[model samples]
Target: AQSVTQPDIHITVSEGASLELRCNYSYGATPYLFWYVQSPGQGLQLLLKYFSGDTLVQGIKGFEAEFKRSQSSFNLRKPSVHWSDAAEYFCAVGAFNQAGTALIFGKGTTLSVSS
Candidate 1:
């Protein structure tokens, strides 16, 4: 079984401040990692993913993450956050099986950005 956990339920940051959101996963084999952002009353948009190769992956909106195999963590980070960046962030893990494959999402962390 594969699972993902996002420790932060909510986070508040001022505009232009650095941000970091924690994520952890449990999987039998190497899992595909992904981060998505969802605005209120909107669907999720992919932020980034880690399939293979580089441990550090970059994404849209100036976001990036590092895959740590030992820690079983893939934490999201941004040097500076904007007010527009306020949204709910989800950490997900993708699993492959004969039946099918799907993403297992975390509870999500709501980000509140203030000016």
Candidate 2:
């Protein structure tokens, strides 16, 4: 089955520290991967996505991810984190079927930034 996995359920980082959120996926073929961020009481916002071509993809808010087919990973990274970056991060895989495309989301990782 095609699914997304976020190993860390929660993570705490000091302000201005580098951050990396791990994400892994299992799919039959090259699948669409996406990272989304959801702030408290806010809807999900797209961070980045990987379709094809370049392995390294840049995203909004100074974020980026590298797609590694061998490792089946698409990890999100930021050189420096801000207090406002603390939010619930979700890794999702897009699955296509006769019913159309649907996103399978991981449990999510909660990021806490400390001063």
Off by over 4 Å in 1: 98-100
Q: What is the C-alpha RMSD of each candidate to the true structure, in Å?
A: 1.1, 1.2
Once superposed on the true structure, which residue ranges of model 2 sit more than 4 Å away at CA?
97-99
lDDT (10s digit) by residue, model 2, range 1-115: 9989999999999999999999999999998999999999999999999989999999999999999999999999999999999999999999665467789999999999999
TM for every model, in the order presented, reads 0.96, 0.96
The backbone clash count of each candidate, in order, is 0, 0
TM-score of structure candidate 1: 0.96
Which run of 10 residues does model 1 get worst, by summed lDDT? 94-103
Instruction: Give per-residue CA lDDT, model 1, range 1-115, as digits (tens).
Output: 8899999999999999999999999998999999999999999999999998999999999999999999999999999999999999999999866557889999999999989
Distance from true position, residue 87, model 2, in Å?
0.3
